[model samples]
Target: MHLAFVAFLVAGISDAVDGFLAKRFGWQTELGAYLDPIADKALLVSIYVALGYYEYLPAWLVIAVVTRDILIVGAIMLSGMINRPVQMHPLPVSKVNTAGQIILAALVLFDQSFGLNLVKLTTITVWVVGLLTVTSACAYLLTWFRHMSAYEADVHSSLKQQKDGSQIKPRHFGQNPRA
Candidate 1:
């Protein structure tokens, strides 16, 4: 259990390493798009579970983290429902929240070595970060809604204009054969 918790921390650190290397070498790829968040989620959720199981951290902390993930999952499902895909772009607040989580989790594990309670400091900070996490989730939702709304409006406007005898038909993709 202890080793697993530390493993999660190391994996979280890898996220930063990958980000730096990607930006430094222009090695960003579609796989990183999926891998980065997945790694973060695994690290976070594993720590949450370990802490809660051992009662090192309050159960509510884990609940809060899970709730944020639920929000993200809901957003993905909503995007799918609307037929508009969403790209995972971590907002600044989200990145901060993630960093806070990684720090708090690592601190919790370190506290075990010293047999001292670090939850007092980590708990307060976690609450602050949790609030930011929720805020970021709401921001993502708003952005997704606006994007899908604009797409629907554009489709409707094009259809309406076509119905009203507008001679400007929409062009097909990459087919500008000058007739």
Candidate 2:
């Protein structure tokens, strides 16, 4: 447990340092933008699952966290399949939720490692994490639905225009229409 706590601490610190360096040095890349969130999600999900499996955290909380992540990823993939790829961005609520999750996990690990009784704190954290998780999921879903709806509307409008013979035709460069 002590080793695990230390490892988690190191991971968190490293993530912070990586972000700082990226921003401070203007070294950000498109791939880094994608990988950073994926790495954070992977770490959080893995820790939550392990804690839940060992009965350290409530099963419901673990399920909620995992399910939200799965839904978001699934939605992104679905959007791509439908020719509307959603760009990944951390919504404000999602950032809060992630912070709460990280804190809760670290608190649990710290309490376990040091054999400290932090049940009250842990209980409060559990509720915060749960609430934030649900709120974030709803926000993301709502945004995705709106984006898809708008895309569909645009497609419908274009089709209608084409059917009415009012759509603009593309002209080739250096070609004379009189020819």
Candidate 3:
């Protein structure tokens, strides 16, 4: 438990340092944009799963966290498959959700490592994490649905224009249709 706690702390510190360096040195890249979130998700998901496996965290909370991630990724993939790839921007609620999850995980790890009882605090944190997870998931789903609906409306409008013979035709350079 001590080793696990130390490792978690080191990982968190390293992530923070990496972000600081990237921003301070203008070392950001497109790949980093994608990789950063992936790394964070991987870390948090793994921690939650491990804790739940050891009975340190509730099984339902673990499921909720994992499910939320899966749903978000599935939605993105679905959008791409349908030829309307959605650019993902993290919602505000998601940030708070992640913070709560981290706090809960840390609290559990700290308590276990030091042989300290934090049942009450841990319980409250668990509830907070659960609520944030659900809320964040709903927020993301709502955004995705809205985006897809707008895309559908756009496609319908374009189709209607074509059907009505109201679509504009491109003119060739140095060539006239009337000539």
Candidate 4:
């Protein structure tokens, strides 16, 4: 059981390392896209369940963390249904949420030896961070819808322009240096 947690902790650290390597060396791969979050959830869920068993973290906190992941996954599915790509840009709130979860998890695994009221503080922080995570997830959904709507509108306008004898071509993003 202890070894499982150590492995999970190392995987959690790799989450940061993976992102750094990806951005630094342009080593982004589709496999990393799938594996990164899978590894994150694996580590988080493993630790959460283990800590819950030990009564270090509350069951409800575990639920919140898992539920947030589900909601974001649902958003990704919705975006896919719309034929729009859901890219993972690390939003600040999401980063904060991740950090909060890691802190909370570590506190739980550490058996709350510190006099910082780890359980109470982590529980409160979980709720606050959970709200931010949900909001950012919603923002991603809204951004996807807006992007699709704008694309459709541009297509419609382009068709109209063509019928009206305008010779304008629909411009690709960033194709023109002058905005």
- Give the winner by lDDT: 1 or 3: 3
Q: Which ten residues in a row have the lowest lDDT in candidate 4?
A: 170-179
Per-residue lDDT of 137 in model 2: 92
Show model 2 residue runs off by greater than 4 Å: 158-179
Q: How high is each candidate's TM-score?
A: 0.76, 0.87, 0.88, 0.65
| Clash list (residue pairs), candidate 4 | none
Winner on TM-score (1 vs 4): 1
- Per-model RMSD to reference: 7.4, 9.1, 9.2, 5.8
Give the count of colliding residue pairs in each prediction. Answer: 0, 0, 0, 0
Candidate 3 residue-wise lDDT, 1-179, digit = tens? 99999999999999999999999999999899899989999999999999999999999999999999999999888887977667667888899999999889889999999979999999999999999999999988877777776666666777876776553332221122233
The Cα local distance difference test for each model comes to 0.69, 0.86, 0.86, 0.64
- Model 2 lDDT per residue over 49-145, tens place: 9999999999999999999999889988888796766676778899899999999999999999999999999999999999999999998887777
Taking the tens digit of each residue's C-alpha lDDT, what string does model 1 give over 1-179? 46765676677667778899998999989897688777678768877878888887778778878787787767766766755455566667677778777777777787775667676887787787677767767766666566565556656777877776543332221122132
For model 4, residues 59-156, the per-residue Cα lDDT tens digits are: 77667667767766776676568654445555566677777777767755554544455656666766775676567566555654565566566557
Badly placed stretches (over 4 Å) of model 4 are 17-26, 49-55, 112-117, 158-179
The local lDDT score (0 to 100) that residue 20 gets in candidate 4 is: 95
lDDT for position 13 in model 4: 73
